[model samples]
Target: SQKIEQNSEALNIQEGKTATLTCNYTNYSPAYLQWYRQDPGRGPVFLLLIRENEKEKRKERLKVTFDTTLKQSLFHITASQPADSATYLCAFNDYKLSFGAGTTVTVRA
Candidate 1:
């Protein structure tokens, strides 16, 4: 079976600092890795996508990865702000996209 694990707890941090979150999995082979941001009850908005062939991909202040050997992916937000507070999800695109529970990030000023 395939499973993904992101931080289930909320991440509280000071504004203007970097936030790092993790995503781990077991018994899964994914073609690509993806990261998304979700606010309150809204659906997840795509942030970045990294292919299995690639080590890393970035957009603006977001970064992501796909490690087949380790069965994990990492996400990072640089110079985070209060406005960046939201739930972060890591997913893998194998056949369909599958997501982790998500980690809520709270940036305080």
Candidate 2:
């Protein structure tokens, strides 16, 4: 069986700082990992995706790193703002899409 886990507690960070979130998985080797942001009552917005062979990927102020050796992924938001505050989710696909519980980020201005 495969399992994914994210930070169980909400993350609180000051505006203009970077926020980092972690996703860990067990018993699965996914081809790629994806990150998404979900605002209250809205569907998740795609952020970044990193492949198993890739070490790192970036898009605008977002960055993602994939480490198949550790079966973990890291999601980063640089110079985060209040608008960036949302529940971030990490998902991966082996045969099917699997998702973490998601970590809520609150960027205080």
Candidate 3:
């Protein structure tokens, strides 16, 4: 069985600082990993996708690094803002896809 875990805490920080969150797992085969952002009751919106062969991925102010050897992924947001406040999720794709419960992030101005 595969399990995905992300910080369940609400990350609060001042605007303009970079926020870093984590995604970890156990018993997962390397295939594909994706990051998404969700606001309130909304569905997750895709942020970045990294493959087993890929080392890292980036988009706009977001960045994702994958370490299959470590069985972990790191997500970073630079120049974060109040508008960036939301829940972040990570998913693992294999025979079936599994997603973390998500971590709430609050950026104060």
- Writing each residue's lDDT as its tens digit, candidate 2 over 14-83 gives 9999999999999888898999899999998888889999999999999999989999999999999999
What candidate 3 gets wrong by more than 4 Å, as runs, is none
Against the true structure, candidate 3 reaches a TM-score of 0.94
Going through the candidates in the order shown, the clash numbers are 0, 0, 0
lDDT of 2: 0.93
The C-alpha local distance difference test score for the whole of candidate 1 amounts to: 0.88
What C-alpha lDDT values do all the predictions have?
Answer: 0.88, 0.93, 0.89
Q: Considering summed lDDT, which 10 consecutive residues are worst modelled in model 1?
A: 59-68
- Candidate 1: list runs displaced more than 4 Å: none
lDDT for model 3 comes to 0.89
Q: What shift in Å separates residue 51 of candidate 3 from its native position after superposition?
A: 0.6
Q: Please give, for residues 65-95, the per-residue lDDT of candidate 1 as tens digits.
A: 6677898888989999899999998888866
Q: Could you tell me every candidate's TM-score relative to the true structure?
A: 0.93, 0.96, 0.94
